[model samples]
Target: MTYETILLAKENGVATITLNRPPMNPLNSQLFKELGHAVDEIAEDNSIKVLIITGSGSKAFAAGADVSEMAYLSPVEVYNFNMGSRKTFDKIENLGKPVIAAIAGITFGGGCELALACDFRFAAENVKIAFPETGLGIIPGGGGTVRLPRLIGVGRAKELIYGGEMIDAVTAEKLGIVTKVVAVDVLMEEAQNYAAKLAVRPSVAMKMAKESIQAGVNLDSSSALNYENQCFITAFASEDAKEGLGAFLEKRKPNYTGK
Candidate 1:
């Protein structure tokens, strides 16, 4: 499918969606629309096992939401826009396959929320992450207020959101917001390598594990444990699981066809 605000590319079981709106790649209504379409395509394409999200230019993964598009919007328009953003983020979070955010330069406001929706994030050493909406007299209308705290804890999330300060890559890593920090030039390469690694795992097991984790997060310990055990049993029934066991017994590498 054609995309105006993003670029989609697939190679070797990995798909990448690059935020293409130049220097800052600010999020807008059109960008959100294109993202929804792109994500839906990715979900339907079995050839794509992993998705890496990043920005085109060196300046930003995404600076923030396009304030110009939102500044004068009616209250109802604003509500609809926020819901669209939320839906896009939820799609990424629940994509079944792993979604990795390859963050560079500035990732603020909605951009930070976008990364949080991913299973994990990798950032360049120069990347700056922030949740600066409170300073603008508005709270994070997207999933930032929800996902950020669940990721980095309430205190840290509050510190970032309330202070509205841009934290560097090292600081973000320290806060557990990003998975790892890499040299700028190797950021994309590293992220792709990680995706390639994930793509080779048993697909059914991976999906089940992801589902269990996402669901388990909101459940009580007893219920979560029970659900995890059910997921384990379900994965054990897959052909890949049998192959894995057989290969282990035979002392050979398993050939997983994502069954």
Candidate 2:
């Protein structure tokens, strides 16, 4: 589908959704709608094993939500808008395929929340990330408050959210927010290469593992273990599992059908 605020491309089992607004791809209602559509497209395509999300220009993955549009919104309108954004982010988080955020330059507020939804975040050396909503007389309404604490410690999450200060790529990595940091020129390349690697793995196993991890996050140890065991059984029953095991015994490469 053609999208005004984003570009979607699929290649070699890896799909990329680029936020097309240049300079700083600020998230707006239109962009959020387009993103939701793009995500739906990716989710339905069985051939697409992984997805990478990034911004068009090198200066920013996304600056934040479009404040100009948001400024005039009424409280009720804002609540609805925030809920829509949260739904989109939640969809990305729950997408069966692994999703990677290729972050560069300014990533703040809603942008930071978006990255938090992805399974992995690959930031460029020039990346600066923060949740600066507090300065705007609000808090993160896009699952940031919930997910950020789960990612980083609660104290650190509170510090970042309350202070609304940006952190450099190095600091973000040290804080475990960024999976890896690379040169600006190679940021997309790194993300693509990693996505390609994941694309070739057993899709069923990957999906099961992702689901297990996500679901286990909210469960207690015993319940989580039980859920994980169920996921393992589901993966073990797939055709790919048979291929993988047979290939291992036969000393040959496994050709997964993503079943």
TM-score of each: 0.98, 0.99
- For model 1, the superposed segments whose C-alpha errors exceed 4 Å read none
lDDT (C-alpha, whole model) for all candidates: 0.92, 0.95
Writing each residue's lDDT as its tens digit, candidate 2 over 43-125 gives 99999999999999899999989898888999999887887789899899999999999999999999999999999999999
Candidate closest to the true structure, highest TM-score = 2
At residue 48, give the lDDT of candidate 1. 84
Count of backbone clashes for each model? 0, 0
Badly placed stretches (over 4 Å) of model 2 are none
Cα RMSD (angstroms) for every candidate in the order listed: 0.9, 0.8
**Candidate 1: worst-modelled 10 consecutive residues by lDDT:** 140-149
- lDDT tens digits, residue span 1-259, model 1: 5789999999999999999999899999899989988999998888888999999977999988999999999999999898889899899999989999999999999999899999989999999988889889999877988998998899988888899988999999999999999999999999999999999998889989999999999999999999999999999999999999999999999999877
In candidate 2, clashing pairs total 0
User: lDDT (0-100) at residue 102 of candidate 2?
Assistant: 99
